[model samples]
Target chain A: MPNCDKVTALVSASLDHSLPLHKRLAVRLHFLICVWCQRYLTQVRFLREAVREHPERLESAESPSSTALSPGARERIGQALRDDRR
Target chain B: MAGNLSDPQTWLEQHGDYLYRCAMLRVRDATVAEEMVQETFLAALQAKDRFAGQSSERSWLVGIMKHKVVDHFRKSVREQPVSDVELMNDEFTGLFDKDGHWKIETTGPKEWMDPSSALDKAQFWQVLRRCLDGLPPRTSRVFALREIDDMPSEEICAAMKLTKSNLWVMLHRARTHLRSCLEQNYQGLTT
Candidate 1:
């Protein structure tokens, strides 16, 4: 339980990128000292990068136009479009 | 509540691809993804005045799309719900073995590096996609919400019905797993 509490403190800062400069400085210093935290930072960095890249190439791999929409569905959207104009 | 968002052509030109890409990552079906994107736009159009411009228009649109995805998942109940996922919790227990025993030290502030051209190219995305697809469905969904959706962890806890501790546990686990997978699979220089 105590350990969990310790991790909780770190989690928000990690997510927010909002640690105070000194604290941020301390974390970087620790990353330099600790292999585990260094690896942990690396993981955080990679996961963030992965998420950013997901949208870039998603359309090319799966083209929406290549999949056929039902005529009825198309008409509903078409009607919705017309209604929006009115 | 209605303005530029009411302008169909202007809205599409501004947000079409952004919404489409966000929707595709979650739904994984192009047609359904397109519908989700369209639905997001329409919903935003209806709620335009609520846009306080607090977050980027991209984040705002993705936030709506995320709720729609959550609803879709809840209704579909796919093969497994998040509770059914018996993820390995022991893996990261060491880092938090004792509260305040070992504080994280971030001194040098490791400079962020752009992935090399080779990694930025097709092979990188392929390796990454494969790794993401390899994650358990629930973990992947949580990871996507936190990382891809760019929603705050607190917001994720509320949306996913998870406690902050549980969310962190899952988040740490997911980040650790992704790190290992990307490092093992992709030849990223930093990883």
Candidate 2:
């Protein structure tokens, strides 16, 4: 059986769809009975999903900033725009 | 938030929040992100005369913000000397034996209690962002380009001047770090 390190690396690499056929088979074969690896894979998958759904993007023109813009920064931007127009 | 682009003050009020969020995710710094958004607005205002009715106003502004983010990264990578030693650590080495066999201590991942529910919380995203910020700048940038932005690997390599192997290594390390961070920080999500 491949070590946990090898399986873990391969599993993470597979997320990019970069593993070859034989290596894919090796990963699959390892997962068949390796409960620990399966759990690890689940953790990685959950992290990916959570990251994708994170409210960091400007979801739409309507969605406001997830974090409030600091007043100082807001003032700075305002001042910069005013100067540019002058 | 989509309307006339004539007023810069209105742009700052309506689109400022959204553009700030966009830049924050890419740069992971409030001051820098705010500056980038400010720069984006300046660029947009300057180019508004040339802004043919091609894309939406927000989209056009975002395109400029993306360029600003890329420029920030390029400058950051050039200014800071990232060490290779940190990238090639023996941290995960103990998980296996010399023969590359899983050691008895290498217990597999623990079942997450309720990952999706945890993700639904607003604080969960804050933690995730913090974890991402904790990553090395170059690694975080590559991960963002590939995962968050969904840029193609070929394009990432070309744009970042990274070889395929180097890109893969960066991604692997980023994933590894994020996974560990999430597991440690979030309840019901253990590795």
Candidate 2 lDDT over residue span B19-49, tens digit each: 8877766776677888898899999888887
Q: Note the B-chain TM-score for every model.
A: 0.55, 0.72
Error of 2 at B150 (Å): 0.7
- The residue-by-residue lDDT of candidate 1 on B1-191, one tens digit each, is 53323355465556666566566556655677668766776777677777876776766777788788877655554342345243554434433435433334322122235554534577666666666655565566677777776778777666666666666666666665665565566655344
- Chain B of candidate 2 versus the native chain B: what TM-score? 0.72
* Candidate that would win on lDDT: 2
- Candidate 2 CAPRI category: acceptable
- Tens-digit per-residue lDDT, A1-86, candidate 2: 66667788788778876778888888889888777777777877766665565534322212223366789988989999999989
Shift of residue B97 alpha carbon in model 2, Å: 5.3
Can you give the DockQ of every candidate in the order shown? 0.21, 0.40
lDDT, candidate 1, at B30 = 63
Q: Which stretches of candidate 2 lie above 4 Å from their native place?
A: A55-75, B1-7, B13-21, B28-34, B46-63, B71-82, B85-90, B94-107
Query: What TM-score does prediction 1 earn?
Result: 0.55
